[model samples]
Target: MATRKAIVVGSGAAGLTAGWRLAQAGWQVELLGPEAQVGGLLAPQPVAGWPCDLGAHRLHAPALQVPAVAELAQRIPLEKRRRRGLVLVGGRSFNYPLRLTDLAQGLGLRGGGELLGSLVHARLSGRHWERQRAPEPQSDIGFGEFVRSRSGEAAYRAFYRPYADKVWGLDPAELSQSCAKQRVSSSAPWQLLWRPQRGEFLHPRGGFGAWMDGLAQLATQSGARVTLCQLSLQHGDLANLDADAVVHTGHLSAALTPDQQLAAQLDHRGLFLLWLVVADGQPGPVDTWYTPEAQFWFGRVSEVGNFLGHPHGRGRVLCVEIPQGRHAADRDFTGDLGELRRQLAQAKILSREAEVSEVVQRFLPAVYPLFRRGWLPRWRLALRHACASGRLWPAGRQGLWLHCNLDHAMASAEDAVRHVASGGASTQWPELAERWSEVRVRD
Candidate 1:
């Protein structure tokens, strides 16, 4: 008997996980993607004689609990450390999660007193941000409202609003608050008095690329054929394809056929990355540093050498992330290496006389799902069409238009593989949609 065949689109973690799972289940699997490297966000890019990931990437601890992830953990052991992140707001440094006491300290005595008073007003009388839910998925309020209600106007102004503006490119008053739920964790006010606890984070021994390579090998060894640099089928490419199922881990915007009018309704996001090769001892020990100050164009910088314990042999490397809107202007990409060096010197992350090597500039397109008010119906309409087609199964961050972290992406692949195995003949679109929607995620 001929083996059941499956074609998995986009060889990122989700697609590779799907390919491995299907192949293990006795199906002949084929994986395809546009890029030669396979990890997606976690995929490490070589720099200055060592590996530097797309940005900062670590196996979020919450994701280690997933069966597939747990299994992968055993295959490839990684170092676990307390995640240490820093944030600079209003010329003051604080913990990345904004611990209550630290936030109070950052605000001077008078400002802190005002913040406390406002908090009392917000919690005792104002609408509880968490309790107040949007009537419909598409009708959710902006992230600013929730932040103001939760932390009061003073706190919101001090940190959240500026951070949102710098990172998301959307005014806090415009984008959906659901984005906050994914990124920020809400703790009890009482917990503010207590010191924030150190939590575990993971990284591979060599680099993120080693971890991705392990995952890719697992799929291939299980009998899945992976084709690098193979783009997902456009109209003409679909003609010769024959498979029991097709799993897409690429952009939904690209998946839309010429006739899908709702395609324009959904807009994804883009990104700019400035990776610098600096002297080994220049940057500090922080894994991630975020700034809400307007003077700095980059929002977050992660020290790759510190995170993975593997520097490029001579000096350390840093990856700075500047999240851009899907429609960011062309001029945004025009800065030169000298400008970047100047910015680093200005920020004091590096010295003016520090030995700096090549500056790699990257522009990533259609990488994130950008949601606006009343976007659900249009997004779901596009998803519904993709689902009803009976041939396509969308998985991963871009595929589902969710900002899923490393672990959630793998779990999504699991969900997609299971849905596809149920057979396309009698599949229900709502059920598939619900499964993807329900998976709990960390940003």
Candidate 2:
């Protein structure tokens, strides 16, 4: 056999796994990325001598059972975090999923009616959406429309619109429902009404980045080389970088040269997160809180200091997340920690004297692909055709143009191994494809 090798670009979970799998399968692999670190968006922060994750950190329990993720988990310490999400709306507190009893009690009869209407709409619409075996929408429709149609006007205003607007920085009407379906947890009126107890949240012992760091070590030791400070793809040049095969994992925008076809296929998302280290405070939940009322500048706020351990360690570290479109650095702390503190005070979630110790801002671009309905078939067709060529292959969120979580990225890596071993890629691997399709999304 010719000394087989492969080049994997981007050091995120997807890139790392692809590189690792191929290398483990006896093909030399070279992994490249744009930053000094290996974990793509899953990077970590240091708060008062402890690790804090700024990006998606926790893993659902179901993810651990996967062989690929399990291997990675074995090398690192996985710890479970508790759930305690709260919503501060209309000067009242609703549990994470929005409890029916709480909503009824807090909002009185009128609020309860609105909540009930949303529930009925969601149940009816959700069934309609799932039953449709025909083609989905052609052009993108806002999540607001879908929610209102399926769940009711009040539901859209109280839950869907506010949540979408805060996260994506666009009217729910402008944003694609594909993103909403992929990212947010499904909530029928009944699900919200019941307020079920979800499973435990998981993260690395030190930092989420630590998990990647450990995975990278395994990949490198298995004969895969990870390189940073390199960008752009030049056909045969990528494969020639001391490897036999190549996996392109960067955002498609970052990979492809200017082309109209490439541009249209590549819709993207931007992200802005502000990290705050505060005195004598913590996130007080598993890892997240969503702001549907838009009282704060951030769509979501996370107390990573608590999940990563080091709770009450002199200071608290919180990450305030804003979708990239509306997040301007010059803007007045758009829903960031400062604003969050202000709102917390108003909601009585925090005391008047509470102050932020430090604030840091981070911006990310093209983190998500804007895939509209009916686009998936065409996308799958194109991807199938492209990968069939055996040279240019899709990898990562942009390359695949789909939503994925960290474990899914690693699973992609494992799939690459199977492809290399079998001498090609195929949809025949139904089980593998289904597994890949279940990846989580962290914003």
Candidate 3:
């Protein structure tokens, strides 16, 4: 039998995983990516003498259970770290994965009473339960409706609404219920307070990029070839590549026919990262600070040193993530560091006296998928069109337009390889693609 050939596009966690798995399965693999190094967003860059990830990233405990991820752990040294973060709202700091006592403290006696009252009202009314038992015909509720139904108006207004708006740059009502179902782990107030804490996560010794590099090394050792180049392939171009199977982990538009691309109208939310060195800054116990307030320019700020347990003598390196919408102009990229500092100080995450020694700006073109209302059918159709060739299989966050964890990406890659091994049928891929859509995004 002739050796099977596979071409994996995009070098993020998913593409690299696919390349490695295909090579391991005795298939000839060629992994193509724009950057010389693998790990798209997972890749780390040198900032202030420390390797800082593009954004705040970590391997959650659940992700470690994936076979591919587990195997990578054996190759790379991973450190177990507890998740510690704060959500700044209404000039108060509340523990993330919020605790009841902390919520009460943050909301105050009367506000806390109101919140509980609202939850009781929601339960007593039974509207949410009724909806769950017999959902509407469309069954595609809005994000605001989903949260309000389960947690009541108070929780939605106080917590979910602002954060959703800040992250996706869409009105909660315009966003799909799928966004809430996937992004939000728990919506019930009691569940939010009483859920067993699973704060432990894994981090590679060198960083997330190192893990990708490790996977790439394993793939290369297994005879897979890697190329550093960007490719734009149309529907007719699939025949040109001398590979039996092509795994696309890039934007959906990249693989779609021009006609399909024009009709899809699918888009992604970009992220602006402002890396700063705070001189003489004392590292806080909190690894990340999430700001939902619209007044603040950034959505989340993370201390890079805390991730690796590296104590810096001069200062701490902070990565501030600012969401950029599609309509945002180029000038919007120029973030105001002074205003950011003022907001941080106001939020009590930073000292007013702290001085920023250096600042660097990095922008990621696509970080989160804009899961607008009525996006499911459109995205599904787009994906279906992209994979109609049977040889092309869409995988990963960008390819599937899924807002998911790194582990999900690896698992998706595994699925693609399995499909290819099972005769690479186009008919079988839609079901697998549907399953990929159900993957939830982990914080």
Whole-structure CA lDDT of model 1: 0.70
Candidate with best TM-score? 3
How would you encode candidate 2's per-residue C-alpha lDDT over 7-105 as one tens digit per residue?
A: 788888888878777778888777878887888777665655556666546787767866768888888968876766767767677776557667767
Predicted candidate 3 versus true structure: per-residue lDDT over 301-415, tens digit per residue: 9888878666534579888888774336253443566677787788777777888788888778778787777777787788788877778888888888888899998899898
Per residue, candidate 1 scores C-alpha lDDT tens digits across 1-28 of 6788888888778888999999988889
lDDT of 3: 0.78
Listed per model in order, the count of residue pairs whose N, CA or C atoms clash below 3 Å is: 0, 15, 0
Name the TM-score of candidate 3. Answer: 0.93
The candidate that achieves the highest lDDT relative to the unseen native structure = 3
Better of 1 and 3 by TM-score: 3
Give the Å error, residue 423, model 2: 0.6
Q: Which of the two candidates, 2 or 3, achieves a greater TM-score against the reference? A: 3
lDDT of 3 at 376: 72
- Note the Cα lDDT for every prediction shown: 0.70, 0.64, 0.78
lDDT of 2: 0.64
TM-score of each: 0.90, 0.86, 0.93
Worst 10 residues of 3 by lDDT: 128-137
Model 1 lDDT at residue 345: 72
